[model samples]
Target: MQYVPFTPYRRVLTLPRVRPSMALMFFARLPMTMTGVTLTLYVVSNLGHGYGAAGIVGAASTLGMALGAPLLGRSIDRYGLRPVVGVCGVTSTAFWIAVPHLSYAVLVVCALPAGFLSVPAGSLARQILAALVPAEQRRAAYSLDTILVEASFMIGPAAGIAAITSLSATVTLSGIGAIFGVTALLIFLLNPPIRNEDELAPIGSVRPPLRSWLSGRLLATLLVAAGTLFCLVGTEVATLAALRANGDVGWTGLVIVVMCAASMAGGIVHGAVKRSLPQGVLMLLLAVLVLPVGLADQPWWLLMLVLIPTNLLCAPTLAATTETVSTMAPPAVRGEAMGLQDASTRLGLALGSPVVGFAIDHSSPAWGFFAAGAGGLVLAAFGLLWTRRRRPAAVAPALAAAVRARR
Candidate 1:
């Protein structure tokens, strides 16, 4: 395709039903970013627990999300968006509201369920894009969605922490619950096209076994998405550890903001640009860029400069993964496919912190950086190899048809 500028994004935004749906999605998903930070702060400051206690609570939620995402996605695919989202919204709201009132032991015990019931807004948003936007325009749409996700990371945690510290944790947590209820209600009212049963019927019409939808191609792309997050989060942890070791811990927030900003900038360009690099290529580049972050250890500014390259690829890799999954899965099972994608990302994020932390503890912060890059490369290689093996087989029938026509 000829290289177009930001015109594609402009066209995408102007399309009917696109703008409002995007807005709803942004509000509805804010809780994803807010929850962990709010929980961390509440557990530590309000409950008078240490970081270790806060971490366990956070892991409970992450584990819940990892387990729940696919099942909920299946529900959305089989039923529809409104009922599934509404139920989740209510359950999640109740849990958040009850968190502060409960004792520490009770809070820990209930944490998993709270996360389990948390709305799968991320997957739902992607499903809407798949259903509403045409295939040709979806790349830009996904890019925009990915950018919003990054924005949530920037806004959600900051807002959540700020509110909890400034106002009462009880009020802030309750307010978060209220936001969930209202966002879910608005989504129900807007009744995005994804809510229509007839539209999703074809996905199940053939009644193909779920195994068929869980194609190798789909799984490989999911791995790429997971690896992308694994590398990104691992690097983040390593960066923090290194900063702490250097007695520059206070600068951590500024450094992260710069890196996220770089990713956002790259995402904007990736969306606006007509042609872009393949997902595999972007993942490989990220691995390479992150590998040397450890060498910049002497000075804080040096670490910031080194991180720019890897961070720049962050959004592009994510946007590309979403676009690939959207293209690979048929409409009938797209929700499940997206759900699997969601699960993979959560798994990566959950694993990244521990893996890098372990490396930092056993060796040094530099080793943590090295491990993130090396681990990311290993995952990227697996994905690339899977694609290489699958491509020729996928096209063989078409090639055979061409040969027969020649004869």
Candidate 2:
């Protein structure tokens, strides 16, 4: 077979449905970034609650998302995209609309259900890309997707904070709900493909058993993905703690922007090149690069400078993980597999904040960086060991077959 070289972003952009689907998904994802900080602000300022109380609500919501993502993905696999989107979109909209009206106690109680039903925009976007972009070109497609994700994060929270501060939480939240409703409607109407035409199974075909597709290699990829997020989020937590400790809190936004920019730059290069580092290697580099960041924490600028190295690996690592998962999963179960990816990353984010926070609280802000990097290395080590252990068994059968043929 003649090899067709990938033309980077140009090839990815030219694919049918890739552009519009990405555009819609980008707007759809903004609410995801906005919701967390917006809810935290609402709980603290409007409900007259402490940050601790707000944290409980945020934790509850995150817990719900973590639990819900895979299940929703399974639903998409079984039922198709529109049905799942319709239900989640309406449920999520109703919850957000009711958020302003609920008491703190009631809001806390409702947060989980609301989060459980929240639109799985990020995973959906990946599913759409996998369906729309051919396998050979997916690296660039996913890289562009990762870049868009970073861009959304850069804008979303700031927009949320600005709106909440300038107006009432009631108004801001209601507006967010409105945006969710509209985006949901658009997604429903658009009904982007979730599987390539050839990969689609017949109606009522037996779904592949979980054991068949959820292989050790796939799990290892998920583990690496979780580790990537754990390191990144932990780094963010450490950066914040470092800034607060150094009386440079005001520079936090600039530092974060710089970090995002560096990640985007890395992603661009990773996609444009014919070859980039594998997910495991990129993740390892990411964790190792941040280990010494604590030493530069004195001035926020210096800390930001130190952070650029690790941050550069960020989007590339994420894009690689998505590409690996997409390749490993059968199209029949791709939604569920993607959902698992979402769950793993969410789990990482959930764990990173507190674990790193504890380190900063007990020792010094510097220790937070240590905690983050160390935790990442530990997770990556486990994935590496797991992959190695599975390899001999995986190869033995093929080797045996080859030996028998020789005989």
Report the C-alpha lDDT of model 2 over 316-398, residue by residue, as the tens digit.
99999999999999999999999999999998888899999999999998989989999998888888789999998889888
State the weakest 10-residue window (summed lDDT) of model 1: 195-204
Q: How big is the positional error of residue 348 in model 2, measured in Å on the Cα after superposition? A: 0.3
Best candidate (score: lDDT)? 2
Model 1 lDDT at residue 260: 87
Give me the overall lDDT of model 1.
0.85
Q: Residue by residue across 131-162, what tens digits does model 1's lDDT show?
A: 77888988889889988888888889889988
Collision pairs in model 2: none
The global Cα lDDT (0 to 1) of model 2 is 0.93
Poorly placed runs, candidate 2 (over 4 Å): 1-6, 400-407
Q: TM-score of each candidate?
A: 0.93, 0.97
